[model samples]
Target: MTKRHQLALATALVAALALGASGCSDTKKGSAGGGAGGVNPAAANDGLTIGGTPAKGGTLTVLSNQDFAHLDPARNWVMPTMDFGTRLLYRTLVTFKAEPGKGGSELVPDLATDLGTPSNGGRTWTFTLKEGLKYEDGTAIKAADIKYNVERSFAPDLTGGPDYAAQYLAGTEGYKGPLQGKHLDSVKTPDDRTIVFELKRPVAEFSATTTLPTFAPVPQAQEKGPLYDARPFSSGPYKIESYDRDKKLVLVRNEHWDPKTDSVRKAYPDKFVVVMGLKGGQIDDRIIAGEGADASTVEWANMRPESAPKVLPKPEIKKRLLAESQGCTTMLNLNNSRAPFNDPKVREAMQYAVDKEAVVTAGGGPALTEVATSYLPPALAGGKQSDPLKIAPAGDPAKAKELLKAAGKEGLKVTFSVSTGDKGRAEAIQQGLARAGVEVVIDTVDPGAYYDVIGDLSTTPDMSLSGWCPDYPSGSTWLPFVFDGRTIKPKGNQGNNSQFRDDATMKRIDEINAMADAKEANQAWRDLDVAIMAKSPSVPLFLERKPLLVGPNIAGAFGHPVWVGQIDYATVGLKDPAKSQG
Candidate 1:
């Protein structure tokens, strides 16, 4: 959900369709190989593979430019961090399948016995824990642990995670989190094995939301509050052995993790060593070179666009490339509650002022970006929706000017807050707005502090570069998380950054949630998107196709559609253990 970087519609739509497919099958032809360059996708695997039955022992190295923002599940909201934590450090009630292609997005049981059973007209959900579920230290995982973690997420101190629990859970209107010695009656554990959620509204697709890290179990006894971000108690295949903040994090296999209880993770590698605070260019060069130790490395960050030219021409390195649809849409979030934007006409004008082609070029050209038309990318968009604003890909400056003139804000000046790394994109936006007779003052923030700065409502500027990918591939995940008025907070996690708190829109969200037919609900969500964009809450920028590079000796490498198009950590292993830093 972070503004990182983005797509073809038909191809990307096919990839998104894979995630919506249910049951024990991965039959769809997804977006893994559909890039502009001749970087073919890897062969499909049955939700699990390491080029065959993967070897059991080796150390897999993960090279990254920066450290994880938050390891605490409650504070985890970004894509790459969730990808790592959900796959390695924690276990949720249900997780998407780890297979390549369509199967990789299917919902599968992890700690829970199965996808939860819903009753009370879908207002109540019940999940039974799989027998023998244990934490890294071999303590039993009880249903109460799940309820406790859910309650902890509501803590005022723990912010930035998904707000689904607070939005839906009944009797939690003003409930402070469990840290205050008060427990949530809405999340009930009738027995050690059974857990029930009493929701205020009927939500048919609630199980998919459980895949989020917020739903991961955290035993209250070991909970360290804010300090837990340093190292969360592990319930998955690996536990933290040592973590030195921005330097490095070494993980060893948790012997207590029962593979039988986990249907998703392969856990092929005995250890994982994450090398952080390295330069992106250095990480890219090392993996492409595939030297000693580097031979068994994979990247936590995507390969830089600058490296594509150096590596693409070589047939040897091209095969190691993983380019796929991330199922994400990058956009500019205009603060709706603030002046200039508070006027709907001014917000509408900003949408027409964006030259997507220029923005796409700054975002690394056609291969990496598709000029977006809706907040829901074409993949989950069902079908092509109308461009109500009559948007031109190159931008309709005249239309923007007309709207600005009508609003009496024709030479509108606004501050654009963007990450230092994304200066090019901000400049392109500045130019595009200038053509529409709007002057933009560029405010560059450090890349590391960008989200935290903009996420705070008091410090947020007039406009900021923002993006969203679904928690899962449903409109339910898309619309509610980004546009729901209730998600807006004063200090942390301004999920609805636009701050468009229309009572009608919020009512429609509840209406769509109540629909039992997935197809009907999906179409309704699409229609609602058209209605919302008409208000111009934010500008739709582009859909993304991510390019990931891996070392030659790295096995089971695939661009996980559900994991922000990064290499799947759980299934990855070392082809030659001797070549690894074992």
Candidate 2:
């Protein structure tokens, strides 16, 4: 069966399970256990009690286990909560428009009044900003602000400065050297409301690029340095009021926001609060205890059949299993520059030794069928191609042994570096490799240090466990960022940790990049996938399943195509038991 069909079947099974489980609940119970009961009327006005009805002026507390290393959009990567700050505080010019067969919800224009078509041979793009736009501090947002923010992303001192930003604006007349820390010659603000960008080559994903938070316009007059980090000047519907590290983050409605007249709905909660550092078990306890209401992120493995069924009362706190389109495919990236892995047969043998299904199933959740045939996930809209890698049929231990013996690297001492925070996951992987006769040395480090070490490709351990969620919903985001040798550096680029180098793959990537049409571009992406898979530089493991638990009142809380964590905050409302079924 096709991978798409397989995903469809998986989704159907999960949905059916949810329906069956929820149907067994008692409807007449006034105070539904597990925080399903309607909010207290008096508490609604005070905004102090969880599960209270919507009030125009109360703090909505949220909890996150991780802390933001940097609030700057360019540096921030983790999502659901990280995005809360970005989406609430900053506004991007061109948002995604809803497109069919693209996996999830489509993108539409967010801040731009109207999106312009490419001109000057697909190199120049002109955007018209909406009139009367104002920043949170009441400064008029002009076209100049957009130009400055885009230029700032290429600044030398910034932690997450994008190399591609320079290339995108390379051909423009004014902003030429900023990417290289010289005078810019490419970006131009032609008028008060007009901003034009010139590119070195035709960029097909230019519109989608605008959705990036780094492109969000910041006031030119806003103070720089430490003050900028503490006090963020923003234009979105909500503004950060206060943040207490490890406790809570409070946000208040931007009074300047006009939901209906401003095109889209403003932030729903009068005040938004995010509770910090709650453990996975603590989150489940809170949900069952009827203390915390609204959404919380859960690790899929932690929410297994045995644990979840016991922790959560069967019918009240209903488990809404969401199959994330963006697969978090974990793999062991080999440093081919090193011995043993330098040989293709050795790498191929190692790939054959791995049981992808066993690893995936052990990780818990559903049995993943659409396993990684390549670097890109199979369900990704445009990434449907045959893997070029000659993988051993199912479980071929005999062939694996033969290949390893032929390479004369039968007993190689391989060290597998695993992150410390996720010890259960790390141990599972270590045990799996051991079964295949691979001498696995587990090098455990803290999550933060682990990421830092991996980022520096020169210091990368022989084989390191790594995973990726797409920056955007395309195979282009996956391949070039991870496998393309051009991006792999002594200090890694955004995603290329594998440090893979191949002339044939690079040639195919260039061909796909040159293809102008979207359909043609997608086909080229598939061809590139085939080339990368054959090398076995990295083994595709499993797609992560994000289980979101929401109250019945919360509607349209599923995943979107581009935006990772945005629920329709505007339309979501408290349902009245008098008018609706329990």
Candidate 3:
């Protein structure tokens, strides 16, 4: 999934930190549990009680700069929306355990009785629904509901989610979705409780894919087609009480929900009130102040780098912060289909010329970004590989110039598409590339629509700013989703921005995908990552670290490692429940 980036803090704010906050200790060394580069294991547990035992029965306010893009599980691919939808409104077949560090990668049963049992040489899988499972409306959640939602993922209209179903499921080659009145025979419901899946090929990690929202059940009777984005039928602990699009959303307890069946979500708060469209540092400011009802608030957005000077310096305020790995790598995507960049030498020159150190500074310094050389995050299998290019962090413009000269494209000109808040990073790249005689023109899109604009092949530019977080802790989620050419489509191809579809690369992907042994597959993926970097389809910028600010009176808040290091909404509660009544 595309990782959302925070806006660049103003130069004035940063300058203030440098000049006036000289006595303050560096924020990186003072993190509560883990180092800035790692996740706090204490914060990533099932209970996630960072601030002690959570008091229940209060309204927990969630502040965000952006609104929910798509609430429908079929359209849920991005992290914030996925984190909210999966933990609150819906339940998947299986889910990752809410533990910190490596333990967070463990997959556990959710609505299903257990992780699916694979047969047919890992091609066919079966899952039995938990007995007495019910929807928000108090109706029995049948196996057909799970099958229907998985089927809807293939619909041309609902095209933004993960492509695992279309890529692996048998008999999905010619089928669209149930909207067109075609049933996916590959997904069979032998009874109300039993569901079976027939795959196009053997996938040993198929059970991990079930943790995605694509596997969440949506009863065909309640389906609203495209309008399901407005309000999806709740199958979890919370039901949508009211929604006002980009402004606000209110969720109340699903009276029909039974905690006995759910193990991943604690659902401690009585209600959830999400406030959207608060730009810049507004959410951070409110939480830092901790006044009245604000004391019970937690944020969905990252803490602004500008606010770090105020919050990170003081022991009291710093204690309320959560700085952790997002398991994402931001990069500059070089269009493999477009001119100038389609040439490998030109792409390599751009890769060498771009300064990752400057890019990191533009993004908010070392506390928020770790210079990344490999596309694979350190959290996943095989971990991060050493830089194949062997270029310095400041970049090698001289080597870039030589490469450009050899390619006969020394004076190359290309447009770089960046979202609204990424102007500083775009400028940093522009300045860096100019040193190698390549001119970059900055093209900006609205922050919310950035992915849609760049994702469409028709509208995408020669180069763009993009980032990816694995769907789970697997190399399959990293490479195949982003680099595999076979998955690239005419529209909604958000994952494969680089569009590298070489025959050799595609063949290697198939070979690695076929491996059943986890250890062997991971090693193959690491080797393939090095081979792909040789092609220079994209330039790895940095690994992201999210710093979150929590209200003083908010308790049990932590950055969930599985949720792209965002605060786990389901686990957070009010420290003082009575104050929220104000």
Number of clashes recorded per candidate: 6, 25, 1
Regarding lDDT, does 1 or 2 come out ahead?
Answer: 1
User: Can you write out model 2's per-residue Cα lDDT over 72-150, one digit (the tens) per residue?
Assistant: 5544444443345445777777654322124333446666776555777667777888777887777778887777767
Q: Give each model a TM-score.
A: 0.83, 0.77, 0.87
Report clash pairs, candidate 1. Answer: 6-368, 6-544, 6-545, 7-369, 7-370, 47-99
Candidate 3 TM-score versus the reference: 0.87
How far residue 507's Cα lies from its native spot in candidate 2, in Å, is 2.9
Candidate 3: lDDT over CA atoms?
Answer: 0.79
Sort every candidate by lDDT, greatest first. 3, 1, 2
User: How do the candidates rank by TM-score, highest first?
Assistant: 3, 1, 2
lDDT on C-alpha atoms for all candidate structures: 0.77, 0.53, 0.79
Instruction: Write candidate 1's Cα lDDT for 1-582 as tens digits.
Output: 342332222232223222222121322222222222332222222122333345678888899888988889887877767888999999999888886656677788888889899999888899998999999999999888888888888988887776778877999988879897899888889998899999887887788889888889999998888888888999999999999999999999999999888877889888999999988778889988989888888887766645665565455776677766677777788988879999999998888888876776566544455567778865466433345566667889999899999999987889999877677778888999899998999998876677778878888899987777777767887888789888887776635767778888999998999876666887898889899999889998876666677888888877777777777777888777777868
Give a tens-digit lDDT track for model 3, residues 208-239. Answer: 88989999999999989888988899999999
Model 3 segments more than 4 A misplaced: 1-49, 155-159, 179-181, 277-280, 304-306, 337-340, 381-385, 402-415, 437-462, 487-493
Q: After superposition, how far is residue 395 of candidate 1 from its true place, in Å?
A: 3.2
